[model samples]
Every structure is written in structure tokens, then in C-alpha cells.
Target: MAVLLHLDSSLFPLENSGSRQLTDAFRRTWQEAHPQGSVIYRDLAADRVPHLDAATVAADTLPPLRRQLIAEFEKADVVLIGAPMYNFTVPSTLKAWLDQIILAGRTFGEGVPASGKRVVVASSRGGSYRPGTPRAGFEFDTNYLEKVLGDALGLRVEVITRELTLAPVTPAMAALIPQAEESARQSLLRAAESAREHAALVS
Candidate 1:
């Protein structure tokens, strides 16, 4: 049976969270494609994972939570993450989850167990961060994920981004609401398409 590990780190609910919306689209499509498949979900913001501490780092054996997280990650055919940009990066909750699963010899370094796994990231940002944009340099969320999850962990990373997410709520960005809506629409489409493709590939 195929498995999908879904993680949502949005502080807001599905209706209010752009990242959650995208990830929900992906998950729904994936489930439709694979009715018998399994989905392991984690609402990171609500049930936050503990941050890496000295005891965990210094422990000779992997902690129970770390082991469980790693097992789930390794078992998944596709990993979907809802990573809303908080201060230009992923939420601390998501980071904590990553820290737990990323073991040097196991998931990170040479002969990585998670190598070639597909990871889809639903990224939502308040402002535009495309190349040549004013705030392009501040686009750390996706870049950092690509670096850590793709380059380092050797996962096949796919990102679906909804930019200018604040336009609908922030008075200052009112003019870009249309663009933001369009971005969100396109991102949702991409999420569904990506999920379908992965479902087929996994099958």
C-alpha cells in the first residue's frame, strides 16, 4: 500500500491558511487517486514537536519520537508539507520536525535512506519573492527547503508557492489581491496535478 506523510505547520485554519489550502488540495487528489493508500497527518502547529535539545543531540540512541518520525518519513511514497512563511522562513514547528528526522548517517549523509523520496512543499508567503522582485532575496523558505531536503537529503523536492498571501488581509497590499488570488489558484492546480502524478508513479 502506498503511503503519504502530510505535515501542516500553518497557525491558521484551512480556510484562512494559503499553505493549508494547497496541501489539502494535494492530499485530496492523492486520496482520490489511491483510495486504499494511507495518509499519516500531523498538525505541527497544534501538536508542536519538541525542538532539538542537548539531551537529544547527545543521546547515544535515537529517541522514541525521532525514531517514529524517521520511520514515517521513510515509509512514505510522497511527503507533503504545508510551510507558510513566518519571518521569511518555515515555521519553528516544521523545523523541529525536520531536526528530529534528520539523522546524519541515516537520513542525511552518504547512502541516505530517504534519498530519491518525493517531497512536495506548499509554501505561502505574504509578498512576492520571484527573481528580480524587490523581496526576492528574502525568499528563504523554499530555498532553504531545497537545500536541506533536496541537496542534502537527496529528496526530489517540488514546491507549490502562493505569493502575496497578505494582499487579501493587509490593507497595504490591497492592490495585489488579484495577483495573489491568481497565484493561489495556480498553486492549487499544481498541487492536485502533482499529487495525481505522484500517485500514478507510486502505483
Candidate 2:
């Protein structure tokens, strides 16, 4: 049975945000596909992870907490992250969580062969940032996530972004909300399906 780590960092719950709603839908679909698989869900909003300070950073090189966090990461075959873009970047809580899991010589060895894991990030944004759009240059969240997970940690990273540009109440905005929501739902389903397929392949 595959172990999946599901991390939710949205400040808002499913009732108010597209990110949480899509993540829930994806989880249901994934569960249906893999009935025997186990999922460990972590809500950063309800239980916050402490930010790494100077002391923590200094001790990170030889800390038991680092080992504990790495053990959790190694236990999971798949990692699913539901991240909401805040001010064009990841939430602080998610950043803190990342800091905890990304350890040198554990998650990745700096000078040795790269042997990291895989991660899928499902992100929600209030505006469109796809390439060729004016807002595309402002997409620091997805870019930062990919870079951090792939370059720094040596993890294979895949990203799916659900932009809610059309959710506003104005006439023009109201016309696009349904379309945006549908797009988001489809993206979530596709990502979950891909993860299931990848899990089967690896197994």
C-alpha cells in the first residue's frame, strides 16, 4: 500500500476558497482510485509549524527534529500539497513546513548523487498567470515551489495552478467564475489521476 502525504496550507477552509475545495475533490477521487492506499493529512492552518530561527538553523545540521521530519518524508511514496498563493507567494506556514522537511544530506546530498523524492503541488491563485499573460511574470509561487523542491531538494516537482480571476462579483467577473471553477476542478482531477498512475508505475 502506498503512503500519501497530503499537506493543506490554505488559511481558508473549503467553504470559502477554491484551493481547499479542489484539494478535497482531488482527495476523494484519489481515494476512490486507490482504496488500499493510506493518506496522512496535515492542516497547517489548524496546527502551525514553527518558523526556523537562528537557533533552529544553527542546530539544523545536527538536530533530532531534522531526522524525525526526514523519516516522515521517507515513509511517504507520494506528496500532495495544496498551496494557496498569498501576495504572489506561498503562505508563511507552508514555507515553515518546507524549511523543516528540506534538510541537507537527508532530503538531498549536496555533493553526492542526487536521490530525492517526488512531489505534486496544487496551487490556487486569484488571477491568471499562465505564460504570455501580463500576470505571468508575477507567478513567484509556482516558480519558487518548483525551484525549491527540484533544484534545492532534488525532488521531481509537478505543479497545477487554479486561477480564480473570474470570481469577482462584477458583471464581467461573474461571467467567468463558473468557467474558472470548472477549469480548476478539471485540473485537480487530472493531477490526482496522474499521481495514481505514477504510483502504480513505481509500484
Candidate 3:
């Protein structure tokens, strides 16, 4: 059976979270298609991984949590991530998780021949950062995730991001609420599409 590792890094309640909603959309469709497939869920906000330290970097052995994380990652045929942008970047918990995955000899090294795994990232940003916007290149979360999941880990990463997610409450962004809703709708569509595509490959 295909194994999917689903991760959520949202700091807010699920009902109020865009990234959570997007990832949930993909999981629902994917489970519908692959009835017997297994999903391993990890909520980073609730159970944050410890930040990497000098001991982790200097020693050949990994910490217990990191070892477990790496094992789960290695076993997953698909990885689904809900990354909520925080302070101009991905949540620190997410970063900690990624740090564990980018292992030296285990995940990558000479003769390792790339992971070639598939990952889907459902991301959300509170403000507008589309190209040509004043904060255009300020987006650090999705881009960093793409590079690490693709280049460093050798995974085929597909991303769907919803922006201006704070429109409901932010007075200044209230005018762009429609656009935010549209972005969310489009992201959900993309998530479903990608889930189907992944199901076809595995199932």
C-alpha cells in the first residue's frame, strides 16, 4: 500500500487555517481514491521537533526524534505538508523537521542516488507577495521549501500556495478579500488535481 506522510505546521485552529484546509482537501481526495492507503499525520505546532544542535551536527548518531523522523520520511511514498508562513518564512518547527531530513550519509551522500520522492506543499501567506508586488521577492517560505525538497532531498516537489490569507480581519487587506478567496479556491483545485495525479502513479 502507498504510504503518505502528512504534516501540518499551522499555529492557529484548523478551521481558521488556509494551509490546513488546502492540505485537508488533498488528503480527502487522495484517501477517496486510495481507500487502503495509509496516512501518517504529524502536527508540528502541537508537537514541535527540537531544534538541531551542535551535538546533532557533530556526531554520527542522530537524536531519537530525528531518527524517527528520518525513518518515517524514508518509508513515505508521498509527503504532504501544510506550511503556514511565519515572520517572512516557514514556521520554525517546519524548519527543524527539514533539518532532520537533510541527513548527510543517510538521505544524501556519495553513491546515494537521490531520494526521487514526491512531495506536495500546501502553503499560506497572510499578505500579498505576488510578483511585481512591493513585497514580491520577500516570500521565503515556499521558495526555500522548493529548493530543499527538490535540490537537497532530490524530491519532485509540487506546491500550491494561497496568499493574502489575512483579508478577513485586516482592514487594509479587506478590499482584496475576493482575490484571497479566489486564490484559495484555485489552491484547493490544484491540491485535488495533484492528489489525483499522485494516486494514478501509485494506485
Best by TM-score: 1
Question: Which order, best to worst by TM-score?
Answer: 1, 3, 2
**Weakest 10 consecutive residues, lDDT, candidate 1?**
107-116
Error of 3 at 72 (Å): 0.4
Model 2, span 13-114: residue lDDT tens:
787766676667667767777778888888988888787777877873646765666676778877788888999899998998889887665676566455
Q: For residues 169-200, what per-residue lDDT tens digits would candidate 1 score against the true structure?
A: 89999999999989988999999999999999
Q: TM-scores across all candidates?
A: 0.97, 0.86, 0.95
Clashing pairs in 2: none
TM-score of 2: 0.86
lDDT score, candidate 1, position 45? 94
User: Of the candidates numbered 1 and 3, which has the greater lDDT value?
Assistant: 1
- Which residue ranges in model 2 land beyond 4 Å of their true spot? 60-65, 165-172
Clash pairs, model 1 backbone: none
lDDT of 3 by residue, 57-125 (tens): 888777788889999999999999999889889999999998887887678767678868999999999
Q: Which should have the higher lDDT, number 1 or number 2?
A: 1
Q: Against the true structure, candidate 2 has what lDDT?
A: 0.77
